[model samples]
Each structure stands twice: as C-alpha cells, then as structure tokens.
Target: REIERDALRARLRSHTGSRAELAAQLGISERSLYRKLRSLDRPD
Candidate 1:
C-alpha cells in the first residue's frame, strides 16, 4: 500500500500541476499526502 501510494505521488508530481492540485486529484487531503510521503521515507 505504501509503495503504491509513493508511485501514485510520483505520477501525480510528473503531471503539469501544483502539488496542491495533484493531491486533490489523488483524492487525498494535502496534509494526508505530506504525512504519507514522510512515512514512506522513514528509515528502517
């Protein structure tokens, strides 16, 4: 689920839209997106 979320974020980022807009398109709140990104990047 985390990997999928990261890939979704990357795909959204590649589009010609602002981060806010991309988060909207992904159907997640912008704060939630940021939280997810941070969680995914955490070290083991």
Candidate 2:
C-alpha cells in the first residue's frame, strides 16, 4: 500500500491538474487523497 501510495503521490506531483481531478483519476475521493498526502512524512 505504501508503494502504491508513493507512486500515486508522485503522479499527483508530476501531473498538472486540480486535486479533485487527480483524485478522480486514481478512483479516490478528493478528501481521502488529501488525508493520504497529509499522512506522508515528506512533502513533494
């Protein structure tokens, strides 16, 4: 799950889109995506 999370975070960082749009691409809620990101120890 961590690996997937890292990959998703990386993708989120690289892509040029609103957080809602990126979350949609990953099939997760925008709020959930923010929570996941907040849980991370490092900033992108």
> How high is each candidate's TM-score?
0.62, 0.74
Q: What is the C-alpha RMSD of each candidate to the true structure, in Å?
A: 2.2, 3.2
lDDT of each: 0.77, 0.84
Q: Which residue window of length 10 is worst by lDDT in model 2? A: 35-44
Across 1-44, the per-residue lDDT of candidate 1 in tens digits comes to: 86776687687668897768877988989898788778767764
Model 1 lDDT at residue 14: 84
* Model 2 Cα shift for residue 22 (angstroms): 0.3
Best by lDDT: 2
User: Candidate 2's error at 3, in angstroms?
Assistant: 0.3
- Who wins the TM-score comparison? 2
lDDT of 2 at 29: 99
